[model samples]
Target: MNSTLQPTALTEHVPQPVTRTERVQTIDLIRGFALLGILMMNIPGFGFPYTRFPLIYGTPGSTDFYTAMGIDTAFSGTMRALFSMLFGAGMLLFMAKKEDLASGHSVVDFYYRRLLWLVLFGVINAYVLLWPGDILYAYGLCGLLLYPFRKLRPAYLLIGMMLCMILPVLRNIQNTVETKQKRTTYWEAVKAEEQKKKLTDEQKKAKEEWENQLKWTKFDTKKDAEIVRKMQLGYGQVFAKLMPRNSNIESRGMYYGFWDMLGMMFLGMALLKLGFFTNKLPTSTYWLTLGLGYSIGLLLGNIQFYDQVAYILDPGAYVDTHFFSVFDLYDLRRGATAIGHASLLLLVYRSGVVPWLMKALANVGQMAFTNYLMQSIICTLIFYGYGFGYYGKLAFHQLYYVVAGVWVFQILFSAVWLRYFRFGPFEWLWRSLTYWKRQPMRLQSEPVPAAPQTALF
Candidate 1:
């Protein structure tokens, strides 16, 4: 009797992907929105070098400037934040079953395997797809740290998030101080040179540093041409050109971004535990959150956008204002905006007036992994050398045309694909590897269940 019981208990807790009936539509809907919104910010990176970012390609009050301003104010960091939060929520959902939690070892094994594969996929995305800004590697590494925090209460998770945020905030403050000092030193060096005095080593170094920073920010026709040339080269040459940038982003850049991602993940975990993602919270709560989040986010985002434009227009005049205003409360502004976006979308989902759009978005969210990779593949083909080689040809605002096209394709493709298949292509591979067995792919003649609506307030 004891031997039979042991085998039965182990079999009952075997890990598997969440089935259609088990999914939370609200989460899928929000994730789909994020996946689409992210392309707005990513388009510039796909079309131009990093140095060209935040640089308006049109005259003041032109379509280009307005587009840039709008993205900066509304979509810039919020989409990524939402995506990261959902990833955190996914961690909880993955381990939520009581039987799985009780078995412990099987769940742990599956989770780690899933993350490791993600890290590998991240590598391929960066090196092969040539997207230096890939987030999967960071997500996988940070996720490894999340397993230990899984059982912590929501209050404790929130505390942990706040603690995790402190370092990035402090770093931002330190950056502001350093930028002011560098500007002061550079001016002093110029004054000493005008007076015909020999330069001190510190002043010389400061002048060099300041000029180097300007080199990236200021428009130079020659530099732009060079960048375009490199990007429009053959695959091997382009890969070589991108290697240093990609490596740095994957290493040093990853270090700076580490705390930001981890803190957001903690917040995601906390919010999920508090029933925010599942739509279990009161309508009044979401309304309040939406109002407060947007009020703060838009206010701060506009201020930051103004400073960015000012500095871009006249670096000498606005450097101090830009540096000081932008980094301070940067995280808070983005976080608030992200929450606001999620709240607004959830409210829409609750309304039931746009059921068709919601259903399409839910399908997109379900295939987010595939859609994400697909974006990278499609963008690289459109802009990179081996494909159309349209690098640097499109203005900043024109990039959105590409974004719009991608959105339509993904939404339609996801909707149709899910009608016949159980998982998105990449998701299927991920699950199969995690479970160490082949999983079902095709849906049976029995119709897939529609995602259920939440209780109305």
Candidate 2:
């Protein structure tokens, strides 16, 4: 194997086997790991009250808070970054293959159709399925942007990645600074209204508006209970409440995430170009990657997670908003940790340290699409009012039990399904849609790849 980072020769490009035939087992395993790990991060949101989870508020070092913080430190932004990067790498793989397979129609047309379908799926997930945090819409939207950058040089891709990654922090800083400015003006308006002199109407109105804004920003006991009330009513009712928040820029999901997803995808493309995901790197390289990435990433991730949790729970009138300025550097930590995690998984597999475990995880990754959507269905059935009515009933820590159960079931189910099937149900549907022909879903008469492109990137 060549050790240097260089492009494959023109002769290396050949007709791809098929879009549905996944050749990269390592990518599948990593994707499966990221998909499962992400659920750990999302379980709280699905099982407990939004914004205010199972926290003994203001108790920074308590076991409850520490447990949640620990989980966040381990997963949090890292898994999402890994997932996004993997998507980018998959895009490169898919396009590379499709370019060879294109005949009468253009490959770009097929790519657009795939993205548009994803956007449709995202809509269904968000509206009908009622997961406000459904990421498919964001992923598809960013993916549309990715097409133009598909053929960009690795150096340019890295530059694009840096800009996308950095923009969110810059936005956060702008928001924080602007928020402080509003606080200052809010107090001034109040002070003016309290003065002995006659007040201007604008100042009086400003006082009322700013006071309301301040009141709305803080989540108190009553607000938390009211949120629980809305969610516990009916799925339709909750849907009405959450649609705006998930779709718009002002909402937390889009606000914090708008650029970060694109940046991570670009970074993934760069890494894939470097052959980092191909298990082509030397063992020494993998070991060094694991060491430096985790050390630098996890340490910062821990401190930042702690501070954010503490700041959210702070009851002080003068909360330190500056602590949130740490968002500027948070992605580097997350991206690093994600890389560290991928390094560990790849190293483990390459060394044949735990071959059976690798095969199981790879199987799960192969069925990732079906498993990912199944998570949403199962979680909602457990948490929503329409299902078991466990809405707002569980603490953040308790949600992990449900996640663990699903994790076990998915691993086993995927393995079992692949034993007799060509693809997971959803994967088949996606492939059928992409190719304009129904894909074979059952086991073939002869020996065949148990799980083909079902979960393949």
Candidate 3:
């Protein structure tokens, strides 16, 4: 056993492609898209100008709506799916090659090191950086749970993933129905209280304040004092009400999200086994899948878009008056929509399309672990009190300008950094620490094993 071997390393004993295929490019291309598109979702969370977290929970302007419908809806929801699928695909490729290079070490042991590294990176990103929104934490947590199921049949993994994705949706539906029923009861209570007219002035004031806290807190601040009071009262209620739900959501959310990611990752693994991502599929098949996938997604997205608008305008009263709520809410489309985007990305890979863009994207992706953390650090400095303190001050439209500026910096810096170096700075450190041995940082004269290929579906 070469104690120096890495799960991401290319080995001589690994099989070479007989066909003129570009498997590494395929993964890189998909990863490239995932890395860039993830910003669409994350930019909003960087500051208060975009759609608020838990999405659908905040006020947004025309720019926010357009961003949601166009960029965020088109790419944000699906890109992570593509990224997760590539991860799964990579996992399969890594496992396949591990058999050739290392016999004694278990895949679980190998993956534990990887996940631990990821978690450590994520923790640093969350606590040290200004941005607390960290996907690494989520991904690391999920990656750990996925290792044991690696040997399961592809069909079983797919079924398991579907059940996992569905759990959150079902829970959301149950909660929505319950909330709707409770709102009705709450309104009835208010009406009864109004009729009785027995409450003291202080009680009335307190009740009004509670209602304002629940519904109008988003717009309540005009000064630092108001902001401070709002933050305290807001957090107090959040801890009082939402903290109980947090445990429930985090438990189930992590499970569902993990399964969803693993399902795609494993599907990617299975596809790699079949040579789908390695460009082994027929050209005709690629285009057909792309067309079908995008068409279905566009149709569903439109339906969901209309539903959100109707809900925002009238809520129960509008839906009750019209038959428009027949379509599913945008929030409910996460699973299917994610799958649809992944399908489209697969087609792009199969066709070997967009070579230059893919190269830049791959460069970005190669350094993704670094870039992901860097984004948090940079954005936090721009938005938080410990840095720029611009968090709640920026408008929805202005946030787009900030996002654009950051994107330009990341892309240009990524391209420049890769030219002089072999890997992103953090990536170099991660591989070095993982193997407990020094790995080549630049392309050496010695033959380097390319990233492993994927199988056609």
Candidate 2, residue 93: Cα displacement in angstroms equals 0.2
Q: Across residues 211-305, which tens digit of lDDT does each residue of candidate 2 receive?
A: 66545435568878887787776778777777786566324566567688888999998988877887787889989999998998888878777
Model 1 spans > 4 angstroms off: 1-13, 51-58, 98-105, 320-323, 445-457
Give Cα-based local distance difference scores for all models. Answer: 0.80, 0.73, 0.56
Q: Worst lDDT window (10 residues) for model 1?
A: 1-10
Expressed as tens digits, the lDDT of each residue in 30-73 for candidate 1 is 89999999989888888976556545732568888888888988
The best-first sequence of candidates by lDDT reads: 1, 2, 3
Model 1 C-alpha lDDT versus the unseen true structure = 0.80
RMSD of each: 5.5, 4.1, 7.0
Query: Which prediction has the highest TM-score against the true structure?
Result: 1
Candidate 2 residue pairs in clash (backbone atoms < 3 Å) = none
Decide which is better by TM-score, 1 or 3.
1
Better of 2 and 3 by TM-score: 2
Most accurate candidate by lDDT: 1
